[model samples]
Target chain A: MERKLQERKVNNIVCRCEEVTEQEIRDAIRKFNLTTVDEVKRLTRAGMGLCQGRTCGSLMEKILSEEINKKVSELLPLKKRPPVRPIKIKLLAKKERESE
Target chain B: MNKTADVTVVGGGVIGCSIAYYLAKKGADVIVVEKNKGPSFGASGTNQGACPLQLFEPPVLELARQSLKLYKNLSEEIGYDIEYDNVGALVCSVDEKQYSDMKKHVEKKKKQGINVRLIEREELLKLEPTLGENVVVGVEEWESCGVNPFKVNYGFACAARRLGARFLFSTEVGKIEKDKDKVTSVATDKGKIITNFLVNAAGAWSPQIGKMLGLVIPVKPRRGQIIVTEPTPLNKRWRCISDADYLLTTAFDLKATEVSKDKRIKLGVAGVYLQESTGNWTIGSSRDFADYNTNVTMQTIRYIAKRAIKFIPKLKDVSCIRTFAGLRPFCYVDGLPILSKVDNPQNFVIATGHAGEGITLAPITGKLISELIVENKTSLPIDAFSFSRFKNAYLQNLG
Candidate 1:
């Protein structure tokens, strides 16, 4: 378990909500050469946290733009995930099943 | 008696007070007006008060980096103890695939002259022992930290006052009366505040304030919900979760992530809550476009709880005493803070559209506003942030 923490330290926690880390972010950035925050979120889950990257977006965008060498203004916010709030999976499934 | 100050700053939040304190320190007779009874009432007052620079935009990151230096000396400078901690921040991830992706981010951040780096799981445990077993990676920035924002904003206001900046609370600037191209007076709910210069640092209310001056600002409101927890000792050194997507939260380019976002199950960078010296763990946030309204919803609070629960097991037992929401001056059209001299208008500067990162950009924005007003020079480039950049987009979309 201690080893897990150590290994995770170097990895990027893309989604603090899920404890997603840096290595995930790097893979997503390179896998797509991500040009925006939304892509990073979709591919790596960086901004998918409790705060929804509200606190992290600026840093994320800064890190993304600086590393990607793209203009900061070019990045777009990740497509906000639905349920914009947490809903019970049972309720979610009921809604989806009903819609289906 | 000519009581008019050299500068009359509107909306006394962290941004306003930070600007006012600096101006007052520089020997300017400045006056700050507030709709609240005192400082630190809005988002600045309500924030989890994390001063970590890791959760910021690039331009804002640089500004935050600069402000951080001042933050270290803030207690001494302001003669008040601002609860700031530079314990470091981290963004953690799981899975081999996630780890590899973080590698690319590290390489990119390196190129930009930032100190962010990736650590393996073994090192992650060394940094924080309480993380769940599922945790595999953490992008760490030892340079980041947190602050007691209530005190920071309060200190800025009090210090600014002590330094000769005046405060007029419960006063909202309803109109910015301009003559030809220059602002002549700031008309408030109280009356006309005769002044020579105007600084529109009104947070979520900036767009309306800008329009009152007949100047255009692309600022809009986006609401965020936050939650605070009961005291515990699981604190780590101020680490923040990068949440890979948060690194590019504003990337509009289709090729960036390239997936049609309208279909994603979730979007946001998540967790990094360590304990403060007082033994409290402050965690947060959920995003909603509920528009300009600040209300705490059960759904948002539960979302925050589940999000935190997934990462830190200790959170499962902690008590969440409160949940609240604050409005960020969101500018969705273009990813830029609208800053430009009220074109052709002398001594009128428009500074808002900070969106979620207003706190991160507060110090530097204040510096830049001061530079533009006092020396007519900017500490950093202001072209991208020009309030006028949206005019073209606004006009183009008109068709």
Candidate 2:
């Protein structure tokens, strides 16, 4: 049973609101060295969805804290920039001459 | 490839987008270069989005009155749902002194062709039962409207694009390249934009853009913190309600204490609250010179929340979803925006510093700027908003 627990593939869905899986979070953490919930969010879409982290904020924090071996309080969230919500790339792009 | 434009509008806020839309609609090749990824990324996107006809001085009153009519059909004209909700706003007062002042304001606005009425406490209660018992009188502006700020901004950008206007997002203007006295082109992070006309609509950063051209634009960032409350089923149809004290604090008026003649009540929070169509209440705000800081402090948020609860007791039970801040492009000179052609740089036009009134005054401002660009004269009386108003102060400060 302990070996099976170790072999488990971290496929559990963490942020049900954003449909982000624990495997995706771990992969994002490994890929980007994410040490905060907001970092994981930017990388894996963990808490960037409808709930705005209401459902899985703490879970992401817990995973980050455990992965980094640091207090959750010490890990600050990602700095927010403009276009806070996802905007369409096409809408933001320059207009085409053909369309004109 | 070098992009060429007939007019280059800096900043992609509602003002810039509005200007671009009108300019393009008039057959001018326009390009709006925004540092942010999208329009309304500044104060335009973050404001209460109230289109009130009251509480404005003469030209602003006339401009807002016109803009209200423009907003009524802007969504239809632009083929976008700017979500213009035509709900009346109530300017409430809880004290006897406030009531008399509100009466004067209503009378003054009424004479300006605004549909305003002074409602006493009994009728105010009938209109807004959620208002606290301390309400004495209220001024109702039936023509006031609410809108989604993001949609108003992006809608203008999209409509402008549809009309052959080009928008360059995530592109910051680095320098204004000029030849002798005329603005030849605007150099951006991407490339140089060669243009015949240049408009500085950079909002809080308008001064920075002006500095690139050796011009003095006296606009600074006035920090305003607003709190959002989780949606409640109650107060869904509640019109916008606020304490009359907002007029004083909105400007950080030094004479507010002297004018009010009341020293007991602190003036920072005035119970300015508005509900959005999203069911959340976007309660606002505080006006302070934070020098471009948009950080939402716990102190200001707590102050805002406390005052909001005082005005509407039911908000006490509602939890806050989030609190954010936006820097209003406050003009220090006469508290009015600078909208005029630069005397030295003949082709450079400035349309900025609308401050909190940006959302309300965008359309008329756009039309006036376009008129200045195309016809060299606007129908609106803009003698008060000229660049020359700051000339003496500009020289004195330079000295």
Candidate 3:
């Protein structure tokens, strides 16, 4: 996966599960005024596409804290919703439709 | 290190979680204490996610309108898909009386800036052909929308947690420690935590929590049951459908015992139907003041199914997968939601009593509460939902 990421030609892939690159994260930071892992996840879908941030959360936070010139604790973590594992949208939709 | 916080929010439901999220975002040291292990453990987890403007008066309409605007960006902002679909809603009128009443109601709502119009039976059928033949007229609100309630609750909670908000789940607030008409700390089943401010968003249990402070909230539990159908094909164009009389069942004076008995006789069953993205249809619901009993009865479920079938005859063949019940925290004082700070308690804020619209009004509730705590005032005028509105009732109950 690391070799494949280096060979991607355009940039260094940081989050292998989400195929997110360091350049993309930096671009999202500048473009969206992102200062935390949470903001990066929302704008670039860096830690949300796959792995639910298990692989790239710390990396993203380190990059964010460095970019914002803030301590690690100052930057917020990525927000996580239920069903951390991938579930079919059909099931979630079915559950949400009902008014119980 | 002791677990001290700037604000301690009671209840892990949507309202509490949203308030916590906004407060944390505003840089307040927040702690949420919930008896349940996670958020949306109450009525916030249940109910169809309808945010219709026509169903509310001025006070609620203002909040609902603002919340709708916030929901448009909530999914993106929170890094979660709340599935907010602005499909609109239809209020079907089955008789002449209902038709005229609906017409007047639409006019009133229109005056309040709601984008609603009265449609003829032909137009209504054109919009939703599956509607029953008894429907004479319909009032359609084009701006109405639905969302995933659970996602909304969890989204707010997760965002709040990410922003350094501490969540103490499965820790019941056994006692409230106050100092001379001011909130000082909260004693939970796990341990005692000190706090500067307190927020009561305990859904059905808000009144019970208020008893610890000698406050009367006038909120009660209204039990509403719903039924979920299997993956059945529904018209994507069709919006949420509702019988015109759903609001009448939530009257303050109507006791649950009396309404439950009369509903069995006349069965003034109004159907509320919404199709999910999964090709399943959710139909409901029956309301009564069941006093925190969140049990789904076979009788009520059967009645809801029959009534839904009356609205859309196509649902007659769909098999119901399951049934569930949720308790709506209905406040009896002027039928408005309570969102105010008590006079006696210096740092105590009450943000419950939203009833059925809790899901719809949560965003504004959070914004208002955070603004009150952080800025010492609210951007929105919350005079109508003031705690003083129920002061007379609270005094009478005390007597």
TM-score of each: 0.75, 0.80, 0.78
What lDDT score goes with residue B287 in model 1?
A: 49
Docking outcome class, model 1: incorrect
DockQ of each: 0.02, 0.03, 0.03
- The model with the greater TM-score, 1 or 3, is 3
TM-score leaderboard ranking: 2, 3, 1
- State candidate 2's TM-score: 0.80
lDDT of each: 0.66, 0.77, 0.77
Residue pairs with backbone overlap in model 2: none
lDDT of 2 by residue, B225-259 (tens): 77766565646345577678876344535346335
Residue A12, model 2, lDDT: 76
**lDDT score for residue B351 of model 2:** 96
For model 2, the stretches where C-alpha displacement exceeds 4 angstroms are A1-50, A53-100, B234-237, B252-268, B394-399
Q: Write the per-residue lDDT of candidate 1 for residues B1-399, one digit (tens) a residue.
A: 334778899878888998888888778889898887556557776566665565565655576788777777888878877767776767776546677767877776677666887788887776676676667777777776677675677678778888888888778877777788778887777767778788888877887777776666776666666665555674454344434444543222223333435322132214346566666565666545576677776555555565566566666766554455777776767645766675756777777777666665666777778787878878777877776677788888896
Worst-scoring 10-residue span by lDDT in model 2 chain B:
B258-267
